[model samples]
Target: MTVNYEKLRRRFYLRLDAVFSVEELNKLRFEYLSSKSGLVRGALAALIQQGVEAEQLSMWTGLLKECNLALARRLEFIRERESNEKLTAEAVDVSYPARPFKVGLKHPLVRVIEDTRKILTSLGLEHVDGPEVEDEYHVFDALNTPAHHPSRQMQDSFYLSEVGKLLRTHTSSVQIRAMEEREPPFYIFSLGKVYRNDWDATHTPMFHQVEVLCVDVDINMSHMRYCVGFFLENLFGCAKMRMRPSYFPFTEPSAEIDIRRQDGKWLEVMGCGMVHPNVLQNVGISPDKYRGFAFGAGLERLAVLRYDIHDLRSLYSNDLRWKVS
Candidate 1:
């Protein structure tokens, strides 16, 4: 079928002129030309050329240029307005609110550590602390970890120096320091940041740990079980636990402590065992005269298990929304 181009063109222009103001018509024209919609632009141009006067044609051509410039200016204005709005939103988000500011409370992880300390203190364990940056001897050698041990490697542990000084891989270093300083007939517990070369959903390169050590006369596996079981029950509000044989350089007959969750699955909570004779001897204590039991575990892992935290990194993320509730 043959198309009546001029008739169609006049009808479109008539409709456009009826509906739109001069400014809006100019915008529509610019949009049509810029979008390269050939039919619309050709139709409008043909109608303007054929029916319009010479002065009117010049006016329309000038209008087209003005429209293009106005469209460009409008787009820039819109972009600037959007950018200003985003800046305003960011400022509002970061600024203190107009309302009275409530003092920020302790972070959830800090509260968890404090609560764990309170529980340990009640159980006759004194809270102790040690350095985050530690020498190789206190962190590894004194703890009975051999030179060729996997934990001593740079990939698994964060070594700060070529000479092998590092961020402590566990708070167990506190126990080593405690043994060196205090002759232990008493119970000791420590909580602090430790570093390892690990990061994932369930691991962090830096995280907290709680370490417990009980050194006294008649301290045996049974005493170890009792103390650990009591602490787990009190901390989790559940009494069900099972011990599985494991290995640690500083402990003999090492067993990993697992507790039965509500789902009937066993979750390994920590590692505990009789302190190795060599470890005690390293600090000049005869293991034959004074036997002890020691246990250590990641505080983040316990918090994750207890609170159903899916990502271990979330504990340290400082995301207020994720942390608050």
Candidate 2:
């Protein structure tokens, strides 16, 4: 059987010229150029069986090459045109507004912590840290907290199975650790999470606290008073603050510090007082030679008061609509 190379070439170009879409061109290319079942391949196979002359075989090869080149060129042209059309249809106008995108913000609690750290650190206090999971010694006994204290009760605190290990109820434990590691005439602050068996709008099982300790010669309540007032003034911008006598196992004369709100109501913000002689003695510091003051504040409470947030629980809600500013 004689293969009509001229007829095949004419058929290929006729179909190629009629191809209007990339899909149609691809189909046409496969029909004529496929190695396994294409018209060109079948015709070549037939020539192999029929023993076509070398001259005729060379001619068939040249025709096949021309057809393949033409198909590729057509495909490239169609693809380029399609790309341009898509770009034109989807072009953006320079005068149009951009689509809005959301960005994350720092949480209110974190803001309060940083602000407090900045103010206290400026007062010569070095920042320190301690473990959230602490032993009974540092968390309680070393801090002069008696065994019968309410905070030692399981209902008020979280205790572990290790007999003496438990979640720290306050950053005060860090102060004890610092005092044991350093000598007097030093100032340090600890900021991190503390846990208690507590849950309410203003209280969570886990919350952030910043505890400051300054142990130096002649350090008294007056120095503490000035430091506390300076911190509150810088933090809240000229807010009314008052200190009233209170009680804490770690301090000789404990006082609860309060800040007045816009509504003229006083809200307790933190607790402070002179370091107890027992507490200093437990840390191997001489109470007779040196006295200091320590204070602890809740990060969440400070944020709530500063931002005028009504419910403290909302700080932890993680709702996107909740404005930290």
- Pairs clashing in candidate 2? none
Structural similarity to truth (TM-score) of each candidate: 0.67, 0.71
**Which lDDT tens digits does candidate 2 get at residues 1-325?**
2447777888888999899798998798789878888898778777878997987777777778888899889988888989999999999898998889766677777778888989998998899998989999999999888999999999999999998999999999888888898988898999999998988888988889888899998999999999999899998886589999999999989999998877889999999999999999998999999999988898889999888888888888877665534
Model 1: per-residue lDDT, tens digit, 1-325?
0155445445545645453244665555554555455444554477565886676556445545654565566556656767888788877644655887566666667767877888889898899998998999999999888899999987998887557689899988888888999876979998989999988998898888998998987899999898888888888999999999999999998999999988899998899999999999999888889999999889888888888878889877768864346
Clashes per prediction? 0, 0
RMSD of 1: 9.6
Global lDDT of each candidate: 0.80, 0.88
